[model samples]
Target: MSTRHVLLGLLASGPSHGYDLKRRHDEQFPEARPLAYGQVYTTLQRLVRDGLAEVDGTGSDGGPERTAYRATEEGTRELSRWAGEITPPAPFVTNEIFAKVVVSILSGGDPAAYLRAQRAAHMGRMRELTAVKSAAGAGLATVLSADYALNHLDADLRWMTTTEDRLTTLTAEVDAA
Candidate 1:
Protein backbone atom coordinates (compact mmCIF):
# COMPACT_ATOMS: atom_id res chain seq x y z
CA MET A 1 0.00 0.00 0.00
CA SER A 2 1.16 3.54 -0.72
CA THR A 3 1.10 4.82 2.85
CA ARG A 4 2.23 8.27 1.79
CA HIS A 5 -0.53 8.65 -0.76
CA VAL A 6 -3.07 7.19 1.66
CA LEU A 7 -2.02 9.71 4.31
CA LEU A 8 -2.34 12.49 1.82
CA GLY A 9 -5.80 11.27 0.83
CA LEU A 10 -6.82 11.33 4.47
CA LEU A 11 -5.50 14.84 4.84
CA ALA A 12 -7.43 15.84 1.74
CA SER A 13 -10.64 15.01 3.59
CA GLY A 14 -9.72 17.54 6.31
CA PRO A 15 -7.19 18.34 8.99
CA SER A 16 -6.40 15.40 11.26
CA HIS A 17 -3.87 14.36 13.86
CA GLY A 18 -1.82 11.17 13.71
CA TYR A 19 -4.20 9.25 15.95
CA ASP A 20 -7.21 10.34 13.97
CA LEU A 21 -5.50 9.50 10.68
CA LYS A 22 -4.68 5.98 11.87
CA ARG A 23 -8.22 5.39 13.05
CA ARG A 24 -9.71 6.71 9.83
CA HIS A 25 -7.36 4.62 7.75
CA ASP A 26 -8.34 1.47 9.61
CA GLU A 27 -12.01 2.26 9.19
CA GLN A 28 -11.69 3.13 5.53
CA PHE A 29 -9.55 0.20 4.49
CA PRO A 30 -10.88 -2.67 6.55
CA GLU A 31 -9.02 -5.30 4.51
CA ALA A 32 -5.68 -3.57 4.92
CA ARG A 33 -3.56 -4.11 7.99
CA PRO A 34 -4.02 -1.35 10.58
CA LEU A 35 -1.52 1.46 10.39
CA ALA A 36 0.92 2.00 13.27
CA TYR A 37 0.83 5.32 15.13
CA GLY A 38 4.55 5.85 14.55
CA GLN A 39 4.12 5.15 10.85
CA VAL A 40 1.38 7.75 10.56
CA TYR A 41 3.45 10.38 12.35
CA THR A 42 6.53 9.61 10.26
CA THR A 43 4.56 9.74 7.04
CA LEU A 44 2.95 13.01 8.10
CA GLN A 45 6.34 14.53 8.74
CA ARG A 46 7.63 13.40 5.37
CA LEU A 47 4.51 14.79 3.65
CA VAL A 48 5.07 18.16 5.32
CA ARG A 49 8.72 18.14 4.34
CA ASP A 50 7.87 17.27 0.76
CA GLY A 51 5.29 20.11 0.54
CA LEU A 52 2.42 17.62 0.21
CA ALA A 53 0.97 18.53 3.58
CA GLU A 54 1.23 21.29 6.17
CA VAL A 55 0.86 21.43 9.92
CA ASP A 56 -2.62 22.83 10.25
CA GLY A 57 -2.60 23.45 13.96
CA THR A 58 -1.72 22.09 17.41
CA GLY A 59 -4.09 21.99 20.33
CA SER A 60 -4.63 20.28 23.67
CA ASP A 61 -7.79 19.73 25.72
CA GLY A 62 -6.34 18.95 29.13
CA GLY A 63 -4.24 16.29 27.40
CA PRO A 64 -1.09 16.05 25.33
CA GLU A 65 -0.96 18.47 22.43
CA ARG A 66 -2.10 17.02 19.13
CA THR A 67 -0.66 18.32 15.88
CA ALA A 68 -3.19 18.37 13.05
CA TYR A 69 -2.22 18.19 9.39
CA ARG A 70 -3.86 19.38 6.20
CA ALA A 71 -2.96 18.59 2.62
CA THR A 72 -1.23 21.42 0.80
CA GLU A 73 -2.21 22.62 -2.69
CA GLU A 74 0.61 20.56 -4.13
CA GLY A 75 -0.59 17.62 -2.12
CA THR A 76 -4.07 17.99 -3.57
CA ARG A 77 -2.65 17.99 -7.06
CA GLU A 78 -0.56 14.94 -6.33
CA LEU A 79 -3.51 13.11 -4.85
CA SER A 80 -5.60 13.89 -7.91
CA ARG A 81 -2.92 12.58 -10.22
CA TRP A 82 -2.48 9.44 -8.18
CA ALA A 83 -6.21 8.76 -7.98
CA GLY A 84 -6.50 9.14 -11.75
CA GLU A 85 -3.74 6.64 -12.48
CA ILE A 86 -4.59 2.97 -12.94
CA THR A 87 -2.94 0.53 -10.57
CA PRO A 88 -0.91 -2.15 -12.34
CA PRO A 89 -2.58 -5.54 -12.13
CA ALA A 90 0.17 -7.51 -10.36
CA PRO A 91 2.61 -7.55 -13.26
CA PHE A 92 4.73 -10.20 -11.58
CA VAL A 93 4.10 -13.27 -9.48
CA THR A 94 6.62 -13.17 -6.60
CA ASN A 95 4.49 -14.79 -3.96
CA GLU A 96 5.99 -16.96 -1.21
CA ILE A 97 3.76 -19.98 -1.98
CA PHE A 98 5.17 -20.22 -5.51
CA ALA A 99 8.70 -19.74 -4.21
CA LYS A 100 8.32 -22.46 -1.59
CA VAL A 101 6.82 -24.87 -4.13
CA VAL A 102 9.77 -24.46 -6.48
CA VAL A 103 12.27 -24.73 -3.64
CA SER A 104 10.56 -27.88 -2.41
CA ILE A 105 10.80 -29.46 -5.84
CA LEU A 106 14.48 -28.53 -6.07
CA SER A 107 15.25 -29.88 -2.59
CA GLY A 108 13.36 -33.13 -3.12
CA GLY A 109 10.73 -32.13 -0.61
CA ASP A 110 7.05 -33.11 -1.01
CA PRO A 111 5.71 -30.23 -3.11
CA ALA A 112 2.37 -32.04 -3.47
CA ALA A 113 1.94 -32.20 0.29
CA TYR A 114 2.95 -28.58 0.66
CA LEU A 115 0.43 -27.57 -1.98
CA ARG A 116 -2.28 -29.55 -0.24
CA ALA A 117 -1.54 -27.85 3.08
CA GLN A 118 -1.48 -24.43 1.47
CA ARG A 119 -4.76 -25.12 -0.32
CA ALA A 120 -6.38 -26.12 2.96
CA ALA A 121 -5.19 -22.87 4.58
CA HIS A 122 -6.55 -20.82 1.71
CA MET A 123 -9.90 -22.61 1.91
CA GLY A 124 -10.06 -21.90 5.63
CA ARG A 125 -9.45 -18.21 5.07
CA MET A 126 -12.07 -18.11 2.35
CA ARG A 127 -14.63 -19.58 4.72
CA GLU A 128 -13.81 -16.95 7.34
CA LEU A 129 -14.08 -14.16 4.82
CA THR A 130 -17.34 -15.56 3.52
CA ALA A 131 -18.79 -15.42 6.98
CA VAL A 132 -17.62 -11.87 7.39
CA LYS A 133 -19.27 -10.87 4.14
CA SER A 134 -22.50 -12.66 5.01
CA ALA A 135 -22.79 -11.27 8.52
CA ALA A 136 -25.85 -9.18 9.32
CA GLY A 137 -25.35 -5.42 9.41
CA ALA A 138 -21.86 -5.68 7.97
CA GLY A 139 -21.03 -2.29 6.57
CA LEU A 140 -20.53 -1.75 2.85
CA ALA A 141 -16.83 -1.18 3.33
CA THR A 142 -16.41 -4.42 5.24
CA VAL A 143 -18.37 -6.42 2.71
CA LEU A 144 -16.41 -4.87 -0.15
CA SER A 145 -13.15 -5.64 1.57
CA ALA A 146 -14.20 -9.22 2.16
CA ASP A 147 -15.21 -9.54 -1.46
CA TYR A 148 -11.83 -8.26 -2.61
CA ALA A 149 -10.01 -10.76 -0.41
CA LEU A 150 -12.29 -13.61 -1.40
CA ASN A 151 -11.70 -12.98 -5.09
CA HIS A 152 -7.95 -13.02 -4.67
CA LEU A 153 -8.11 -16.16 -2.60
CA ASP A 154 -10.28 -17.79 -5.22
CA ALA A 155 -7.71 -16.97 -7.90
CA ASP A 156 -4.92 -18.37 -5.75
CA LEU A 157 -6.84 -21.57 -5.09
CA ARG A 158 -7.36 -22.10 -8.81
CA TRP A 159 -3.67 -21.56 -9.51
CA MET A 160 -2.70 -24.01 -6.77
CA THR A 161 -5.01 -26.67 -8.24
CA THR A 162 -3.44 -26.22 -11.66
CA THR A 163 0.08 -26.33 -10.24
CA GLU A 164 -0.73 -29.50 -8.32
CA ASP A 165 -1.91 -31.19 -11.53
CA ARG A 166 1.31 -30.16 -13.29
CA LEU A 167 3.61 -31.02 -10.39
CA THR A 168 5.17 -34.03 -12.07
CA THR A 169 6.11 -31.99 -15.12
CA LEU A 170 7.23 -29.13 -12.89
CA THR A 171 9.41 -31.44 -10.82
CA ALA A 172 11.08 -32.81 -13.91
CA GLU A 173 11.63 -29.29 -15.31
CA VAL A 174 13.07 -28.06 -12.02
CA ASP A 175 15.37 -31.09 -11.84
CA ALA A 176 16.58 -30.46 -15.37
CA ALA A 177 17.22 -26.75 -14.66
Candidate 2:
Protein backbone atom coordinates (compact mmCIF):
# COMPACT_ATOMS: atom_id res chain seq x y z
CA MET A 1 0.00 0.00 0.00
CA SER A 2 1.20 3.50 -0.86
CA THR A 3 1.47 5.46 2.36
CA ARG A 4 2.00 8.61 0.28
CA HIS A 5 -1.34 8.26 -1.43
CA VAL A 6 -3.06 7.30 1.82
CA LEU A 7 -1.80 10.42 3.55
CA LEU A 8 -2.98 12.54 0.63
CA GLY A 9 -6.42 10.95 0.70
CA LEU A 10 -6.68 11.68 4.43
CA LEU A 11 -5.75 15.28 3.83
CA ALA A 12 -8.47 15.56 1.18
CA SER A 13 -11.09 15.68 3.89
CA GLY A 14 -9.41 18.77 5.36
CA PRO A 15 -6.18 19.93 6.90
CA SER A 16 -4.99 17.73 9.79
CA HIS A 17 -2.10 17.34 12.18
CA GLY A 18 0.26 14.39 11.69
CA TYR A 19 -0.95 12.79 14.91
CA ASP A 20 -4.58 13.11 13.87
CA LEU A 21 -3.80 11.62 10.49
CA LYS A 22 -2.21 8.58 12.09
CA ARG A 23 -5.18 8.17 14.41
CA ARG A 24 -7.66 8.38 11.54
CA HIS A 25 -5.64 5.93 9.45
CA ASP A 26 -5.58 3.40 12.30
CA GLU A 27 -9.29 3.83 12.89
CA GLN A 28 -10.22 3.33 9.23
CA PHE A 29 -7.75 0.57 8.41
CA PRO A 30 -7.77 -1.45 11.56
CA GLU A 31 -6.51 -4.60 9.85
CA ALA A 32 -3.29 -2.88 8.84
CA ARG A 33 -0.53 -2.35 11.37
CA PRO A 34 -0.67 1.09 12.88
CA LEU A 35 1.75 3.69 11.57
CA ALA A 36 4.37 5.00 13.94
CA TYR A 37 4.50 8.70 14.85
CA GLY A 38 7.93 8.97 13.29
CA GLN A 39 6.67 7.47 10.06
CA VAL A 40 3.74 9.86 9.92
CA TYR A 41 5.87 12.94 10.58
CA THR A 42 8.56 11.83 8.16
CA THR A 43 6.06 11.20 5.40
CA LEU A 44 4.45 14.55 6.07
CA GLN A 45 7.83 16.23 5.76
CA ARG A 46 8.43 14.50 2.45
CA LEU A 47 4.99 15.54 1.21
CA VAL A 48 5.75 19.12 2.12
CA ARG A 49 9.13 18.94 0.44
CA ASP A 50 7.57 17.50 -2.73
CA GLY A 51 4.87 20.20 -2.76
CA LEU A 52 2.22 17.52 -2.50
CA ALA A 53 1.25 19.01 0.84
CA GLU A 54 1.79 22.30 2.62
CA VAL A 55 2.31 23.04 6.27
CA ASP A 56 -0.73 25.21 6.77
CA GLY A 57 0.11 26.33 10.30
CA THR A 58 1.16 25.24 13.77
CA GLY A 59 -1.11 24.94 16.77
CA SER A 60 -1.25 23.04 20.02
CA ASP A 61 -3.96 21.60 22.23
CA GLY A 62 -2.04 22.03 25.50
CA GLY A 63 0.85 20.04 24.06
CA PRO A 64 3.77 20.74 21.82
CA GLU A 65 2.94 22.73 18.72
CA ARG A 66 1.82 20.50 15.88
CA THR A 67 2.19 21.37 12.23
CA ALA A 68 -1.06 21.10 10.29
CA TYR A 69 -0.92 19.95 6.68
CA ARG A 70 -3.25 20.40 3.73
CA ALA A 71 -2.98 18.55 0.47
CA THR A 72 -2.04 20.55 -2.60
CA GLU A 73 -4.18 20.46 -5.74
CA GLU A 74 -1.55 18.31 -7.40
CA GLY A 75 -1.67 15.88 -4.46
CA THR A 76 -5.44 15.56 -4.78
CA ARG A 77 -5.09 14.82 -8.49
CA GLU A 78 -2.38 12.24 -7.80
CA LEU A 79 -4.55 10.59 -5.17
CA SER A 80 -7.47 10.48 -7.62
CA ARG A 81 -5.30 8.87 -10.28
CA TRP A 82 -4.04 6.26 -7.81
CA ALA A 83 -7.59 5.52 -6.62
CA GLY A 84 -8.75 5.00 -10.22
CA GLU A 85 -5.97 2.58 -11.09
CA ILE A 86 -6.63 -1.15 -10.68
CA THR A 87 -4.08 -3.01 -8.59
CA PRO A 88 -3.03 -6.16 -10.41
CA PRO A 89 -3.04 -9.49 -8.62
CA ALA A 90 0.31 -10.70 -7.37
CA PRO A 91 2.06 -13.04 -9.77
CA PHE A 92 2.19 -16.76 -8.92
CA VAL A 93 5.95 -16.94 -8.69
CA THR A 94 8.25 -19.15 -6.62
CA ASN A 95 8.25 -17.97 -3.03
CA GLU A 96 10.54 -18.76 -0.12
CA ILE A 97 8.53 -21.82 0.93
CA PHE A 98 8.70 -23.31 -2.57
CA ALA A 99 12.40 -22.55 -2.82
CA LYS A 100 13.05 -24.10 0.58
CA VAL A 101 11.18 -27.28 -0.36
CA VAL A 102 13.10 -27.66 -3.65
CA VAL A 103 16.40 -27.10 -1.93
CA SER A 104 15.49 -29.61 0.74
CA ILE A 105 14.74 -32.21 -1.92
CA LEU A 106 18.06 -31.53 -3.68
CA SER A 107 19.88 -31.83 -0.35
CA GLY A 108 18.17 -35.17 0.40
CA GLY A 109 16.18 -33.67 3.28
CA ASP A 110 12.55 -34.37 4.23
CA PRO A 111 10.43 -32.18 1.97
CA ALA A 112 7.26 -34.03 2.99
CA ALA A 113 7.86 -33.18 6.62
CA TYR A 114 8.42 -29.53 5.66
CA LEU A 115 5.16 -29.45 3.75
CA ARG A 116 3.28 -31.00 6.64
CA ALA A 117 4.66 -28.48 9.08
CA GLN A 118 3.81 -25.59 6.72
CA ARG A 119 0.27 -26.93 6.24
CA ALA A 120 -0.21 -27.07 10.00
CA ALA A 121 1.08 -23.53 10.39
CA HIS A 122 -1.24 -22.33 7.64
CA MET A 123 -4.20 -24.01 9.31
CA GLY A 124 -3.38 -22.35 12.61
CA ARG A 125 -3.23 -18.95 10.97
CA MET A 126 -6.51 -19.59 9.18
CA ARG A 127 -8.17 -20.35 12.49
CA GLU A 128 -6.82 -17.12 13.97
CA LEU A 129 -8.05 -15.09 11.02
CA THR A 130 -11.44 -16.77 11.20
CA ALA A 131 -11.76 -15.74 14.81
CA VAL A 132 -10.83 -12.17 13.94
CA LYS A 133 -13.38 -12.08 11.12
CA SER A 134 -16.09 -13.42 13.36
CA ALA A 135 -15.36 -10.70 15.92
CA ALA A 136 -15.11 -7.93 13.33
CA GLY A 137 -18.84 -7.32 13.52
CA ALA A 138 -20.28 -5.58 10.41
CA GLY A 139 -17.23 -3.49 9.52
CA LEU A 140 -16.91 -4.07 5.79
CA ALA A 141 -13.26 -2.99 5.60
CA THR A 142 -11.98 -5.31 8.32
CA VAL A 143 -14.11 -8.20 7.12
CA LEU A 144 -12.98 -7.79 3.51
CA SER A 145 -9.33 -7.54 4.53
CA ALA A 146 -9.58 -10.73 6.55
CA ASP A 147 -11.33 -12.48 3.67
CA TYR A 148 -8.56 -11.50 1.27
CA ALA A 149 -5.86 -12.90 3.57
CA LEU A 150 -7.85 -16.08 4.33
CA ASN A 151 -8.35 -16.74 0.62
CA HIS A 152 -4.65 -16.43 -0.09
CA LEU A 153 -3.76 -18.70 2.82
CA ASP A 154 -6.29 -21.26 1.57
CA ALA A 155 -4.64 -21.23 -1.88
CA ASP A 156 -1.22 -21.67 -0.28
CA LEU A 157 -2.41 -24.63 1.76
CA ARG A 158 -3.83 -26.26 -1.37
CA TRP A 159 -0.54 -25.75 -3.18
CA MET A 160 1.36 -27.29 -0.26
CA THR A 161 -0.85 -30.40 -0.34
CA THR A 162 -0.35 -30.85 -4.08
CA THR A 163 3.37 -30.32 -3.74
CA GLU A 164 3.57 -32.89 -0.96
CA ASP A 165 1.96 -35.50 -3.21
CA ARG A 166 4.52 -34.85 -5.96
CA LEU A 167 7.54 -34.72 -3.62
CA THR A 168 8.79 -38.14 -4.66
CA THR A 169 8.73 -37.26 -8.37
CA LEU A 170 10.34 -33.91 -7.61
CA THR A 171 13.12 -35.57 -5.63
CA ALA A 172 13.78 -37.98 -8.51
CA GLU A 173 13.91 -35.15 -11.02
CA VAL A 174 16.32 -33.20 -8.85
CA ASP A 175 18.54 -36.25 -8.41
CA ALA A 176 18.62 -36.77 -12.19
CA ALA A 177 19.61 -33.15 -12.72
Scored by CA lDDT, what does every candidate get?
A: 0.93, 0.91
| Predicted model with the maximum lDDT | 1
Model 2 TM-score on a 0 to 1 scale: 0.67
Off-target runs (Cα >4 Å) in candidate 2 are: 58-65, 91-96, 113-153, 172-177
lDDT of 2 by residue, 34-145 (tens): 9999999999999989989998999998999988999999889889999999998775766989999988988888889988998999999999888888993648877888
lDDT of 2 at 47: 91
- Residue 121 CA error for candidate 1 (Å)? 7.1
TM-scores for the candidates: 0.61, 0.67
Best prediction by TM-score? 2
Q: Can you write out model 1's per-residue Cα lDDT over 1-177, one digit (the tens) per residue? A: 799999999888789999999999999998798999999989999999999999999999788999999999999999999999999998998999999999999899999999999999999999999999899999998999899999999999999999999999998898888
Please state the error at residue 101 of candidate 2 in Å: 1.8
